[model samples]
Target: MTERIVVVGAALLDGGRLLAARRSAPPELAGRWELPGGKVEKGEAPEAALVRELREELGVEAETVERVPGEWPLRSPYILQVWTARLRPGSPAARPLQDHDALRWLTPDDIWDVDWLDQDVPAVRETLTRFPTETR
Candidate 1:
């Protein structure tokens, strides 16, 4: 079997809200909501890559909380892994500086409000399990 490359996605939460980003490029994925993050580079830890990707893509300093416990297949040679994350103290507010065109912070009650990318739906449902529904 061919080795799969890891793409780390951040389930960034604040005030019990999950952050979702809308893709603007790579025509096929455009307009679909997803947890914002990017590919893990060779020899880099997945958690570390997620932090770096957030800085580049969202312009926020964040730290990973925990792995979300499963992987999903993306397009050829890429697999999706997610980590719950939060903005570091004093970090700037997240903005769609790159890769994304817009961002939304969805409450647990409204998490389904966005039109998520098909592949992201399963991963998102899994992430929700980590949170207490009573919180947000």
Candidate 2:
């Protein structure tokens, strides 16, 4: 079988909150919420791809803080990996200028408030575990 494509998702953190974006494309996924990220270029590293994706999708520069510790499979030919990320020192705050129509910073107790895309549930669940106990 052919190797699957890798897609990276960012659990962008600011203080004790995680970022979430609302999709606006590809009919089926429209209206669903997900971590903001995109496909990894063939020769690129997943962390690099995540930084690139956050910039492209949110109009902000970010740095990968750490990997979220597990992988989730998408439909054939694609697998999703998540990483913790934070905005760069002088970068602007994230703005939804592409693919996504909206953005929100979610507290640990509010993690279940968004209607996350089905394929992203596993990664989201894993991310919640990384939040500090005081925040939950």
Worst 10 residues of 2 by lDDT: 127-136
The regions of model 2 sitting more than 4 angstroms off are none
> What CA RMSD would you report for each candidate?
1.0, 0.9
Local accuracy of candidate 2 as per-residue lDDT tens digits, 1-136: 9899999999998889999999999889999999999999989999999999998999999999889988999988999999999888899988998899999999988888999999899999999888878898
Flag clash pairs in model 2. none
Clashes of 1: 0
> How well is each residue in 1-136 modelled by candidate 1, as lDDT tens digits?
9999999999998888899999998899899999999999999999999999999999999999999989999998999999999999999989998879999999888999999998899989998887767774
lDDT of 2 at 106: 95
Provide backbone clash counts, one per model.
0, 0
- TM-score to true structure, per model: 0.96, 0.96
